[model samples]
Target: MTDDDPISLPAHDWPEFPPGLVWLVGAGPGEPGLLTLQGLHALRAADVIVHDALVDGRILEWRRADTQLEYAGKRGGKPSARQRDISHRLIELSRDGQRVLRLKGGDPFVFGRGGEEAQTLVQAGVPIRVTPGISAGIGGLAYAGIPVTHRDVNQAVTFLTGHDQTGLTPAALDWPALARGSQVLVMYMAMKHLPKIADALLAAGRRPDEPLAIVSNATLPGMRVLETTLGTASHDAEAQSMEAPAIVCLGRVVLMRQAIDWMSQLQGNPPRNPDPLGGGARTTG
Candidate 1:
C-alpha cells in the first residue's frame, strides 16, 4: 500500500490469534480511536467477543462480519452478569475451540478485574494473551484538560478505586496516609460514595478548598466536566446530578484546565482563566 493508505502490517508480523486461545484486550476510555493496534487485530480475528459496558460500539464495528458479540457488561444498579460467570464463559468458549476476545474498558490491570479474570483463566489451563489500553483516569482526565501531574503542581499522583465489592467506600484505604502521601488523587467509580469519601478525606486533613473536577463520559463527544472544590464536591455533584462512568480528579493539577482546555480551544473558544495560577500570567500547572 502507498503512504496515503492505511498501515497494514504483513500477516506474519502479527501475533497468531489462533482458535482455542482467549485474548483479554483493553478498549480504552470510551474513545474508539484509543484502541491499541493489537486490540484492533484481536477484534478483527476473534470468533466471539465478550465485552463490558465501557467498550465503545464503534470499536466493535471492526470485528469480522461473522463474529459473535456478547454483552457481559456490569453497570451499577443494573442487571449484570456476575464476574464468576463471565470468567467461566471464557473458559467454556476456549474449550469449544473459539477465538474468544474479552474486551474491557481501559487498562485491563487497572481496577478492571482483569487480574482476577486472568487468574481464573490460568487456573482453568486456558492459554491467554493481553493487550492494555489507556486508562480513563489518565486519558479521560486529559480530554477534560486536566493533567494528572505537573512538576509545579504535584510530584506524585495516586489512582484508587472508590469502593470495594460491597459498594461502600474502601475501608482498607488509609485515608490519612493517602491525604499525606499523594499530591494528586484520581478516583474510579467514586460517584456512588463521593460524599462518604469526601468526609473521610476531610477527616484525614485534606483541605476543603482543594480543587476537584469530575469528568463524565470522558473522551466522548458528550463529555461533561464539573469543576468544584473538595468541600462541596458532593453537593455540587448532587445539584448537577452527575452520572457514573466518570473519572474524579483531586489536586492542584486540575487548575491546569483553566489554561489548556484544548477541547474548548478546538471549538475556537479561548481559555476561560488565562491566569489560573493567580500571578496574572498563564502556566501549564
Candidate 2:
C-alpha cells in the first residue's frame, strides 16, 4: 500500500481478543473521546457488554451491530441492578462462551467495585483482562481547571468516596486523620451528604474558608464548576441545584483554577491569577 493509503498497517499488529473471556474496561469520565483504544477494540469485538450508569451512551455507537448491551448501572437511591447479580451475570455470560466486556465509568479499579467483580471471576475460574481509563478524579478535575497536585500548593493528594456501600458517609474512614494528614482531598459521590462530610472536615480542623470546588457532569457538555468554600459548599450546591456524577476538590489547588480555567477561557472569559492563600501579596527587597 502507498503511504497515502488509509489502511497502511497489517492486521497482525492488533492484539488477540479471545472468546469466552471477560475484559473489565474503564470508559473514562463522561467524554466519549476519552475512551481508550483497547476499550474501543473490546467494544467492537465483544459479544456482550455490561456497563455502568455513568458511562456515556454515545461511546457504544462504535460497537458491533450484533453486540448485546446490558445496563447494570448503580446510582445512589435509583432503582438499579444489584452488584451481586451483575457479577453473576458476567460469570454466566463467560461460561456461555461469550466475549464479555464489563465497562465502567472512570477507572474500573478506582471506586468502581472492579476488584470485587474481578475476584468473583477469579474464584469462578473465568479468564479476564483489565484496561485502565482516565479517572474522573483526574480528567474531570482537569476539565474544570483543577489540578490534583501542584508543587507550589501541595505534595500529597487524597482521593476518597463520599459514601460507602450503604450510601452514607463512609464511617470507617478516619475523618480526623484525613483532615489532618491530607494536603488535598478529592471526593466522589459526596454531594448527597456534603453537609455531614463538611462538618467532619471542619471538626477535624480544616479551615471553613479553605478553597473548594464542586465540578458536576465533569468533562461533558453540561459541565459546571462551582467555586465555594468548605463552609458554604453544601449550601451553595443546594442553592445552585447541582446534580450528581460530580467531583469535589479541596485545598490550594482549587485556587489555581483562577489562573488556568481553560474551559472558561475557551468560552471567551479571561484567565485569572488570584492569591490562592490569604497571606496577602509578597514584598521583596
> For residues 144-173, what per-residue lDDT tens digits would candidate 1 score against the true structure?
999898767789999999989987889899
Give every collision pair in model 1. none
Off by over 4 Å in 2: 1-12, 274-285
Global lDDT of each candidate: 0.92, 0.90
Positional deviation of residue 81's Cα in model 2 after best superposition, in angstroms? 0.6
Q: List model 2 lDDT by residue over 83-104, tens digit each.
A: 9999999999999999999999
**Candidate 2, position 119, lDDT:** 99
TM-score of each: 0.94, 0.92
TM-score of model number 2: 0.92
